[model samples]
Target chain A: MNQGWTERQRPPRLERRLEFADYETTRDFLDRAALVSERLGIYPDMSFGRTYVNITLHAQDDATEVGEPSRHFAREIDILLETEKTLDE
Target chain B: MNQGWTERQRPPRLERRLEFADYETTRDFLDRAALVSERLGIYPDMSFGRTYVNITLHAQDDATEVGEPSRHFAREIDILLETEKTLDE
Candidate 1:
């Protein structure tokens, strides 16, 4: 859904990086991402610092192709990023 | 001081890998780390998945040594992990 995502192959996954102005905003996004993971049962690997988060949604199997679940989860994360951005304004 | 920590060279830093039995425990550790960071004004870079977190405390400057502040922060984090472990029992 969000064109900002980058598709990566080899093992297959989608990744996106988002930057925030400060620690508070980054915390908010991480907390929201956790909630979404709970609701959808999709837990992406996330690496974050004070001002940024790198999220990776790996393919569900070893078929060398990404699937619906990861794409769906990425879309939800994209939505959360948008919501976080709006709050920053 | 907990001997479980690993010290790195080059840029110089202290690092430790913590494992949790579940996501809830992992979240608790992350939350407590944030609180400690705010109180002590030290923020370590962390990368975490569902069950583990890698914490790295960089040297305060370019002197190529992990100083007192980073050591103090690591001890506090060690304490937090101990407390979390007690709660788990």
Candidate 2:
């Protein structure tokens, strides 16, 4: 147990790594995500100049064998990012 | 860097620790959260029950001296839990 992780970091810089099914799904997910954040009163402060949303994915890794769920998530997040960009523009 | 974390854990057991402003807000957030998950094609499998939603709060911790944001989040999650219970009934 890294004591440094707990004591030094009171609440610590919390982050989320949500998985999804595919790109289209991720895009749909982001729409709902923004709504959820808004409802929670924790609006996304992209200008906060901090690592607010650090979303990563793991699609079918034909090279090293991945899980169905993992691949699905990676594809989903990727789609979410793409959709976010389009929505922004 | 704990090599065990990378090699042993392929995709790794991902978790999310979302923070909110207050209890009511968290409840609202949960409603949105469910919608978002469904949109993402990552519907909540509460039945699987393997540390899916591990929400914690740090509302006004007079004992250790916490921050407003942290306290706000804790209070929010507590409310969310309460609301979830009520919704179930």
Best by TM-score: 1
- The DockQ assigned to candidate 1 is 0.74
Candidate 1 runs further than 4 Å off: none
Q: Each candidate: fraction of true contacts kept?
A: 0.68, 0.00
TM-score of model 1 vs. true structure: 0.92
> Which sections of candidate 2 miss by over 4 Å?
A1-51, A55-64, B1-29, B32-51, B56-64
Give per-model TM-scores: 0.92, 0.34
Model 2 lDDT, residue A48, Cα? 9
Q: What DockQ do you compute for every candidate structure?
A: 0.74, 0.04
Error of 2 at A18 (Å): 11
Q: So what's the TM-score on candidate 2?
A: 0.34
lDDT of 1 by residue, B1-89 (tens): 79889989987888898888888788888888988888887778888878888888888777678888878889999899888778768
Expressed as tens digits, the lDDT of each residue in A11-45 for candidate 2 is: 22222344444544444554455454444333322
